[model samples]
Target: MLLSCGQPLPLLRHTDVPPRVVENFILTGYRFPNYSLRECLLSAFRPTNETGNFWTHFLPFFIFLYYFVEVFGWEGAPHGDAQFFYPLWNYFIGVFCLLMASSMAHLLNSMSLVVREVCFFVDYGTISSYTVGSSLAYYYYIHPRAGTVETGGRNDSHMDLKPEHAGSLTSSYAILDFSVFFETFYIPSACVVAIICVLSCCNTRQRWRRHRYLIRTFVFLLPFLVSSTPIFYRLLTRSPYLSASSSFAASTSMSSFFYRHCLWLLMSAVFNISKFPERLAPGRFDIWGHSHQWFHCCTFLSILDELHMIKTEVRAILLSPTLLLPPAVLSRLPGPTVASTYGVMFLLQTTIISIIVWFSWHANSIHGPERDQLAKDHPKKPLKCH
Candidate 1:
């Protein structure tokens, strides 16, 4: 169902800046200043400014939903294999939550400032969740002893794994490994989340508004620092398993995984910052070819890219018994087939989106003072189209 392109959605601007094709615009905005939830969602079927942002995320959720249901939801991840399959399921949870949060944020962002702020909160949290989920895969696949199979023979499995592999490998899955790995990321990511929360509170404050997107990009990229630091450290320090060609390849695979994730993330940031085609040509780029759309697409692809990397590594660890370590939760996870994980994540997001919409609608009614006051403080010239 195609709607007319360049349909105007009432954009509540705080400045005299010209309007871009989409950020918060909806199809129904052409009909009325503020549309109902029915109109906002129905607009998803028709074209609008929010359409790209919405579909960029909207489509990914369905992919993730099917993956969780058909693959992780029904698959059996039995003994000694819990780490790989279960963590993957959880990672999908993070991916979809992120997609949903971002989708709703774009969809309702034009509805009201109050709604936008709430969506921003969910977006920030989802980012944190995705980071954690991505990193946990590292815990499973990038063990310190990854190169052991190459250093020694398959017979080496008879001996104690960590000790035998200690000289050639770093002997991962220790308490310290878990601590350093998670602490470095969790602390910084949480800080970013907290900062995002504060930024949301200052939503109407024009001082931070000028740099909001920049600040967000900065925080969004910060977690990469924590994640990348350790990967490089291991790649340099960990010995390569040169004897067996495959072992050497497997040993370095974790680095490849991180590289792919970083590459896509970098692309996402570029799309976000450049606003390229859209920036160069004003209204011409409105209906399509914007940075945010590229950003969303890049982000979606990145998740899949890393997921592939993690899957390969998990297979390596399981298929090669020499690579397996003693029982440790460093990479441990619940049963993948446990239907509850999917159910919980689905319910949690549904509840959150529902609550956000309800609150936003209510906020729209009473938020006149706040919105008007903010607008007064940062008034924009009336739209040329109007």
Candidate 2:
């Protein structure tokens, strides 16, 4: 079939498409299966339910790529400071992988059932990787130091300590030294959470098949919560902002950007779960303004805000020498760099997704002939145009 921006192949109604690809309340603009590869590529220019989903991330992918290259050339690779740039590189790569995977999944999933399942599985894996990317950036560049809290941004050694209270103070300090533990295991914990998220998401896709929004949301949200534990802890304790110095402005900027991103993430989650506006008026919003499109936009905004937050904090840390943790805190920090962490997560998530894809392909191979026969026998009736 000829697919183009001006004249596209005839779109299918909701009832005309297979149940697997159907979106709730989207009554029109569904594409049929087994389109040629060229047709699938051209479908991005065609008006369909998934066209927005494709372009939304596809366009943003280039935008992110530009930023990545800009950063990579400017300071990331040029400076040769792996300590500082590796986390940023990891974050950029994750965003790139996520956007490309999601856009492709939306674009070419109609080629076949197994292809669709594998595409979504890969998409979930990229999301998991992105969570780890965020965690790496947060752990390396944004986490508040334990000394910052104990000293309250001051260098006083005897300001508050008394001879009689020294022992209790030591115990209290020990109790409050949670940052050490978090800093040590934060990236590793994020990697574990990401793996679990992929498994749960793929499992939900396989098992639930339909009405799995809540389960999918819960699984994905768990990873975000876990990856952002340091951010939540910092925000709640306001540890980084306790000082009333010039750095206060820098801290405020970082916090404000963080808040904006958090809000974006919340909105994205709501859209993903609620599927509103389109749900309220099914056919009217079928070709546009769907919740998934909104989710993509919100998530893109969240990433932008997060990038700004990290950049701002990095600048602050560089300018203020005192912001660097003392020897005691640095000694407790994790040994592995962000690059190493990304390498490990990349290998693990790839292996897990490969196994899931194999399972999905195998399961579909067994059932594929029957489903094809059913489609051939019970061809859809001609749908009336609205």
TM-score of each: 0.65, 0.81
Which ten-residue region of model 2 has the weakest summed lDDT? 146-155
Residue 329's lDDT within candidate 1 is: 30
Candidate 1 residues lying further than 4 Å off, grouped into runs, are 1-33, 64-86, 143-207, 239-253, 321-367, 370-386
Q: How well does candidate 1 score on lDDT at residue 181?
A: 39
- Determine the backbone clash count of candidate 1: 0
User: Against the true structure, what is every candidate's RMSD?
Assistant: 7.8, 5.4
Best by lDDT: 2
Tens digit of per-residue lDDT, candidate 1, span 1-386: 11234343443332332132124321222222234465567677665556788889988878756544443333232353353455565666677778898898777754445655566666766776666555444544454332222333443332344555544343432213444434334434533443444344334222465566666676656556654444554565543343344444554566676678779988888876666666676555555666778889988877776766666565545544545443233233222343433443344445445544554565566555666665566543333432
Task: Report the number of backbone clashes for model 2.
Answer: 0
Question: For model 2, how does the per-residue alpha-carbon lDDT over 137-218 read when each residue is reduced to its tens digit?
Answer: 7776666442233432332332344556544543432444566557657667777878888877887766875757777777
Candidate 2 wrongly placed segments (more than 4 Å): 3-8, 66-81, 144-175, 238-248, 321-331, 334-339, 370-386
Task: Give lDDT per model, in order.
Answer: 0.54, 0.70
The TM-score between candidate 2 and the true structure equals 0.81
Ten contiguous residues with the weakest lDDT in model 1: 24-33
